[model samples]
Structures are given as C-alpha cells and as structure tokens.
Target: MLSQVIRYDGSMTSPSESAPLDGDELETWSALATVLEWLPPVLDVQLQDGWNLTHFEFGVLYALATAEGRSLPMSTLAGFANSTLSRLSRAVVRLEKRDWVRRSTDPEDRRVTIAWLTDSGAEVVASAAPAHADLVRRLVFDSLSAEQAMTLREISRSIAAAISDEGGWRPGR
Candidate 1:
C-alpha cells in the first residue's frame, strides 16, 4: 500500500512518517537534481560540436570499440548503451550509412543479430577518445582531489546499484 501525500504549510511530506526534508537534505537533493538536468546537454554539446556524434552514438561506438572482437549482439549493445533496441537499431543504421558499423546475424543462432565496429569506426573512436577524455576530465574530475574522486566513485556506484535494484534493471539484460 502507498501512503497518501501530506502537505503541511507549503512543504510536502516525505514518504516516511509524513516528515519533511530538513534543510541539509533538501539542499543536497536540489543540487543533485540540478546536476542531473544540466550535465547531459553540456556533454552533448561538446560531443556534437567536435565529432558530430550525439552522446548516445558515441556510447554505442565506444562500447563496441572496447568489446572483445569489437562486436556484441544488438540486444547486448542496446543494454550497454542504456537504450531500447529500436533506438539502437536506428543509431546503428545511421552509423552503417557512415561506414562505421556493420550488422549481421549470428551464424549459429540466426535469430540473433550482432553489431561490429568497422576499421573506420575504430579509427573514429580512437581519434575522438582523447578529446572526449579531456572534456570529461575538465568537467568532472579537474576539481576533485584523488581522495574525493575515489569517494565519488564509491558513492556513485552505491546509488546506481540501489536504483538498478529497485528498477530490476540489469546492464546486459
């Protein structure tokens, strides 16, 4: 059963005990929400301006580039890219038009479709990687001490796991 939303004064109650967020909790959550809304466009702008690739396109290519045999089944690639299969297919089609990726069926299991990064695709990813890394470092890591970076890694992984567990999401499902 779900609890009813309760409002006291101008503030809504928290899920538990109809408690409102205290000042510190409210500030932390607001900051996180702002970052979530702001970061994706910043990343997209950098990638789009430099490489003409949306972050999603770059992610798909990057995943294939780092994979063994430079290939994965379309379903697996979609999962790795955090995209639905239909969206991945459309992106793959665009990449195919650019001669960056190729698609084929698995010989042993014809029902399965696979995607492979072409030599050209490998070249593109290789060329784009340094710039991407630089931007990521500048935007994300430049301000952090090594200790803070490690702490962030631990915190982010815990949060991600919690969200995934609650949503029943598996990266390669």
Candidate 2:
C-alpha cells in the first residue's frame, strides 16, 4: 500500500514522504518515460517506410542474418529477438512470404525448427542497415556528448541488469 498528500502548494507529496523523487529525479524519470513511449514507433516507422518492415520483423531477420550460417533454431531466434515464440512465428511467416526467410527442420534435432535468412533477406537487411543506422544515430547519438553517451550506455546496462534480476527477462537467454 502507498499514500501521499498535496498541501496548498501545487507539489505532490512523495509516497509516504519516506522516499521521494526530488525535482531532478522526477525530471529524469519523466524524460525517460517520454523516450520509452515515443522512440519505438518512430523507429518502426523508419523501418516500415524505408524497408517495408516493422522493427520487430527487421530484428528477426537481422538476428538470423548475423547468426552462424545465417540460421538459428526458432526458439533461439525468438530469444535473440526478445520476442515470444508466437510473435516470432508470425514475423517469420511474414518474412517467409517476402522470400526473406525460410524455415527448416534442424538436421541435428528433428524436433527443432530453424529459421534461415534467405539470400534476398540478407540483401534486404544489408540495404536497410545503413538507413536504420543513420536514423538511430541522428535521433540518439547525434544529440549526446561523448560523456553523456557513455553515461547513457552505463545507465542502460544497469537498468537492464536490474530488470533481468527482478523479472527474469534477459534477452538472448
């Protein structure tokens, strides 16, 4: 349970006042929240407009394109893409329709299915990489000072670690 009070001033009482975000902390949290809300769709639009792919689909294809022999077991690929098997299955089906990827039974494990990037898929990913990279650089890196960039990386890693520890949501696991 939690509680707060607002006095005559237009300020929020911190939760129980035992712990509270100070002004700077509140500002930082708000900024992070805004970025989290806005960044994904911006990213998805760039991929969709320029490459005819959603970010998740591109991510799946990109993962396969970078894997050994341009292939991975479906389960492994889902983990790498940070997606559920069902969602990854849907994305793979769309990619297969585009001839960008193909599915096969793993030779060493008949029970396992593998996703492989087709030649056309590899070509598409290669072509899309530059534009996507440029957009990311512009939106994220271009605004940061070197020190800020390093701080952002460190902060992100720390947050990811905390999430993994608390929620058991490690990617590529």
Give me the candidate number with maximum lDDT.
2
TM-score of 1: 0.85
Error of 2 at 54 (Å): 0.6
Report residue 3 deviation for candidate 1 (angstroms). 6.4
- What's model 1's lDDT at 15? 71
lDDT by residue (tens digit), candidate 1, 55-142: 8899999999999999999999988888888889999999999999999999989999999999999998998889988988987799
TM-score of each: 0.85, 0.85
Query: Please, what are the lDDT tens digits per residue for candidate 2 over residues 54-86?
Result: 999988988988898999999999888887888
**How does model 1 fare in lDDT?**
0.87
- Candidate lDDT values, in order: 0.87, 0.88
- Per-residue error for 10 in candidate 2, Å, reads 35
Candidate 1 at residue 12, lDDT?
A: 51
Candidate 1 clashes between residue pairs 3 or more apart in a chain or in different chains: none
Worst 10 residues of 1 by lDDT: 5-14
Question: Alpha carbon lDDT of residue 79, candidate 2?
Answer: 80
**Top-scoring candidate (TM-score):** 1
